[model samples]
Target: MYPKILICDDVVYSRTMLKNILDQIGQYIIVEVENGKELISELLKSRETGAEFSYLFLDLELRREDGISLLREVRKMEPLLKIFLSGGISLTDENIKKGIDLGVKGFVSKPYKSKHVKTIFKSV
Candidate 1:
């Protein structure tokens, strides 16, 4: 089966851009959400269906909620979930450290690159 990927970003452009890149890499079951609430909902649904997502591309700066806080909650719900963080200017050193501490797999900044995304896709 194709790997499942969940992308949560408040910005429409960011989510679309990342989805496009992943589409180019290979076959994947990709789901997009605009906020943490939707993301959590998706996760719960996956758990109920017995088809957990293989990866998560989460944004560090969400308009309605804090990404790190959301990440903390996600970790509790799905401790083994492979999470990669994304952000533009708000991707600071401290936040990166916090995410690392919270057990994120890695990070990809804004303006998602196809090559970088491919590498991440392969690693997972």
Candidate 2:
């Protein structure tokens, strides 16, 4: 199975920033989507091709859909998926708990930093 990286964020700049960081670290095939619908579509397409994401960088706040809801659906499909929440807003404890309950692996706050990215990769 080919390793994939999925990035779901409504903000173009956020996706670009993360992509740049990933590109700097290695040659990864990163995919980007602006909404939950697109995210689902991409996941399905990847699955059909016998591929799974090594990690998913999902934004908590999308333009039209909540990421957590999508996360629930995705968890059912890829139970072992590595998911990281991202957003400009600080996640409350309750929300963080909710994410954990839904099987998210971690959170990546906005204004991306090298250290945060490094930590996530190190775990892998």
Candidate 3:
């Protein structure tokens, strides 16, 4: 079966862009969530169903909550989930360090590129 990928971003365009990039790289079951609540709901459902996503591309700043805070909660629930931060602005060193400390696998800068997405997908 194709691996599933979850993308959490407030902006619809950002989610579409990332989905497009992933589509170019390979076939994947891509799911999009607009905020932390939806993200958590999906994660919970995945856990209950035993169909957890293989990857998550989470935006650093959501409309309601920041990704770091959400990451903390996620770690407590799904500690082994592979997460990548997607930031539109350049992330501060401190924030990056915090994310690393929290178990972020890597980062994908805004305006997603197909090449970079391909590399990340292949590596992991």
TM-score of each predicted structure versus truth? 0.94, 0.91, 0.94
lDDT, each prediction? 0.91, 0.84, 0.87
Model 1, which residues run further than 4 Å from truth?
none
> Candidate 2: global Cα-lDDT?
0.84
Query: Candidate 1 — which pairs collide?
Result: none
lDDT of 3 at 30: 96
TM-score, prediction 1: 0.94
Q: What is the C-alpha RMSD of each candidate to the true structure, in Å?
A: 1.1, 1.5, 1.2
Off-target runs (Cα >4 Å) in candidate 3 are none
Worst 10 residues of 2 by lDDT: 86-95
lDDT of 1 by residue, 1-124 (tens): 8989999998898899999998888899999999999999999999999989999999988998999999999999999999999998878999989999998888887888888877866776
The ten-residue window of minimal lDDT in model 3 covers: 86-95
lDDT of 2 by residue, 1-124 (tens): 3468999998998899999998877778899999988988998998898776778998888878877788888889888888988876747777788898987887777888878986876575
> What total of clashing residue pairs does each candidate reach?
0, 0, 0
Superposed on all Cα atoms, model 1 deviates from the true structure by an RMSD in Å of 1.1
Instruction: Give the runs in model 2 whose Cα sits over 4 Å from its true position.
Output: none
